[model samples]
Target chain A: MDLPSRIVITEEGPREGFQIEPGPITTADKIALIDALSVTGLSQIQVASFVNPKHVPGWADAELVVAGFAPRVGVSYTALWFNDSGLQRALAFRGKLTLAGFISLSASEPFALRNLNRDRAGQIEAMQNYARLHWQAGVPIAKIIVMAAFGCNFGGDVPAAKVVETVSDGLSIAREAGIEVREVSLADSMGWATPRRVAAAVGAVRDRWEDLRIALHLHDTRGQGIACAYEGLRLGVTAFDAAVAGLGGCPFAGQPGAPGNIATEELALLCEEMGIATGLDIEALIEAGRLAERIVGRRLPSAALRSGTLASLRRKVGP
Target chain B: MDLPSRIVITEEGPREGFQIEPGPITTADKIALIDALSVTGLSQIQVASFVNPKHVPGWADAELVVAGFAPRVGVSYTALWFNDSGLQRALAFRGKLTLAGFISLSASEPFALRNLNRDRAGQIEAMQNYARLHWQAGVPIAKIIVMAAFGCNFGGDVPAAKVVETVSDGLSIAREAGIEVREVSLADSMGWATPRRVAAAVGAVRDRWEDLRIALHLHDTRGQGIACAYEGLRLGVTAFDAAVAGLGGCPFAGQPGAPGNIATEELALLCEEMGIATGLDIEALIEAGRLAERIVGRRLPSAALRSGTLASLRRKVGP
Candidate 1:
């Protein structure tokens, strides 16, 4: 296996999980979860999503969560937003939150239609507006995130060509706004990705733009997230986004269709066990997962949270 | 990927789930689960374990369950046993079950000592008697199962050399009884397997015995089972053992150390979606997974059961 020696993981559990959970998960609980995650040696932690409170009541306290959490040294905190309003809300905490821009696009047209209620042209027009606003705010466009890059819940199978096409759309938007994007995150938003899809999408994107770095934001919707992540490691793609205890996806069958992202501790286990460094404290991450589960008032989907890190087991076996 | 054109899956949910669940789950529920599984186009199903009732009260009604279910014509039903008494009980249902024998050993000696309370010499001696008894009873020993083949909770990381050595022990016992073993099942009983370990172990064993058919029994303990299975597929392995709704493992972290095996439908999805034939009806198998979850009266860990197959979504996209 030609695996990268060290990889960077972007913790998206706080943003992804709290947004979907039905609970009015308290601002304090959200803050606590973020604070717990901050000490786990993660470099990037997306603490909350700045969105319309009416649409996402769960994240209505996004500002409170952002202000309450005690950010750790060397940890870069970030948040999610889709438009100028959300970006302005994020701008309130300039230094506390590291601000960056993203040109987000859906790889599947049907997904774009169903999710954002926009056609190709309308979607491009909207993103052009989004990129310009961020540039006006002096937030450098960090990367292009291609949602449904592998497959979609509404739009059956997404071929490799479609992913490449989708990336082109984001790049076009960035170009129109005079923004330079250096990375791409192929996201499996609905869990339609198999390892083959991950390989094809990553391969196709890289073939088109050799110098662009690739990251994976995988969902364990169909239980293949870890495998997809494994394939990413084999391809020497190092950046990843995971949820602690698999927060942010659907909790079970018959929910909202999309399930959890791959668990942070589990991914760390996969990487560290294979001699690849994730620079995470598996024990602390598992603790954070349990804390997230408790605050959500339900079990989360992470198997690692239940079985825990092998460190304790290894101790039992001795050196 | 040198993927297989087709693969065979052995369904072990009925036996694996019931044994661990803290339930006096009625014989009817067990029988119903087995019957439901029979229609999912699976060729093999392990229905029950004829163990001492006092030890595994879950399978105490094994006799009743064995007699109760209506088996499908094309499906082969099997059962598990360790001693002469359990074998005799299984023998009583000879016509109902397709009986086969196995030489089961743990690759980790510490695991053997901890799980079975037996040392290496003690385990081999016990297996020798067991194999001789099975041979006399006319039950062909089908395979040698190396448990904790990749890693173990009790023994930490199990080297590939140790796995080869453990398989050698099983073969030695088989040779003593003049029983020819043509297959080997590398089992990650405690969910300690990673893709690299899977590759090393499979490679080592195949190097020693070129003609032996290799099968994988994986656990999703640290959420690496599917990825390991993907690696197995890359190595051209064509046989696997899985649980419906990811049965027969630990449910949560503070529980037993081991968790579920790879979910059956998810494995089927991995194969079928990749254009590999699994001879499984993905929908029917999902329905079966739901039934297993209902019988167990808890949420299972299968993401496919929740998100469902892409067939429904495909219908939305015109051919």
Candidate 2:
């Protein structure tokens, strides 16, 4: 099958990867890492999440991290926000950062309640209000994320139709605020997605909304993350969410040891061999992974880090 | 994007997984593991490899291991042979076992010499002689394996043309021995293959040898093993080689810590989600993975084992 020649890799290692760690990472270290990633040719990097300090203490220094970002010419430093309080903080940095709005739908009612403290209907209502508030503050929402789009921790197989319906509901809110919904991301938050499910969901979204740009935010919890990304590429998804050093996991995922997102360098390895133009320097990405490992003080779960790339291996053993 | 509805999974964990460990596992442990895998509905299990005992001390008791297998009715218990001496040992167990012949082509001359004590031409000649001897001894040779088909540890970016030429030479040898070549396997021994390389090579093989039953033996060294398998399935390969508990690696691949073949349970997860029938019991395969971890005394590189499957996760967090 013909695949797109270029794909966008949105780095989440600094933000998502850092948040789930047990203790705090220094603001200086976070800034240094983001600055290092800036020169790695990524089009976008999720620098921090404007979350409640009590809920996510590791990112309590979000303001400091954001202020310290020495922006590269072409890279957009982005931040994620979950509620009104987070959105207010994101809006405070209006010109310096791109605000990322999130809306997660749990396929299982129990998961919805446990993770978000709201059922699907209540979550949708809350999201509609958030969209309106963002619009009032002059922040136009272009995309919304749908978490657990494949399957859920509390439910085995989530229906694709439910995910599409949830996206439609989010899009309706965007329409109410007079904002064009340009993108929708399907997140395997629990890493419950397989290639077939990814293809089916992406295909369903494409069929329903023709012009909308689709992206995938996959977790390696089930080992099928890379496969799902590959399937997404075949189905024409041009953007993906990944972490450096394979850091990050859902705190409410019930399993604390579940793997993080697909490692950025691992994804780049696939793109590099496929001749897909990711515009990433593999060496720099490797360095970023090393920095992540140092920041976390653990061996991160990156395959490329564990086993060096084919070229690097040859260099070591070359005649 | 039409795909085949079913695929074949060849289990190699018992032989490949066990052989690489530093110490010896009892003959009884090997037998028990193979017997457990037999019930998991695999069509083929590579039970042992007859190599130099000094080189692979793990399989030194190959004769005892082969004699003890209580055969499953439908499953073919197979053994791998490296040379004339190994072939002689395999012929002794002819009635009870299916012999698996292997010949690896290293893209780098140094790798070929260090691993096989042969250059490209010499390895081809040796493979031809082996094919003739096997045929003379009444064992029909129809399949040959080409390792480092993607890239090599000592040489990066192995030419696809070289792989095709190597396979062609092996087929010629089989034909010379009056054996109709029916199967040829491409092995990413160093785990360096990507989806596009897999597609390109499979497309080339399909274009040339239209009716050949192609197989892939992939390693997860670079973390693209599962993705490569998915691509191969899209391109119409029905057979795959996986190890139980994600075991097996090239002893000469420069990095001893590199990952082995794709985990069978992990592959089953993909197959189950894709709706491709592999006739394997996933729960049984997972149990087999746990057993492998116990035998190897380390956590095998299987995502399914670390993070339970969707079904198991749901069970844990379900209402």
The model with the greatest lDDT is: 1
Clashing pairs in 2: B13-B244
Across residues B146-254, which tens digit of lDDT does each residue of candidate 2 receive? 7788888766777778778877887787878777768888989788788988987877777788888899989998889999999888887889999977887767675
Stretches of candidate 1 off by over 4 Å are: A250-254, B250-254
Q: What docking grade does candidate 2 earn?
A: medium
lDDT of 2 at B36: 86
- TM-score of candidate 1's A chain against the true A chain: 0.97
lDDT of 1 by residue, B109-183 (tens): 887797689888888998999999998999989899998898777778889999999999999999999999999
Query: Which digits, one per residue and each the tens of the lDDT, describe model 2 over residues A1-319?
Result: 6788999999998888779988667898899899989989988999998899888999999999999979998888899887788888888898789765765555556667877788878887888888878777777675778878888877567778977887898788788877777888888878888888997888888889998898899998878999999998888789999998688887768667667999899998888878788999887888888888888787777777767766576677665
TM-score of 1: 0.97
Please, what are the lDDT tens digits per residue for candidate 1 over residues A1-319? 7999999999999999998888888899999999999999999999988999988888889889999999798999998899988999999999999998688888777778976898788888989999999888889888999988876666678899988998998888898888899899998877888888888999999999999999999988888899999999999999999999889883322347446889999999999989999889999999999999999998788888877778878887789
Candidate 2 runs further than 4 Å off: A24-29, A67-70, A106-110, A313-319, B24-28, B67-70, B103-110, B313-319
Candidate 1 docking quality: incorrect, acceptable, medium or high: medium
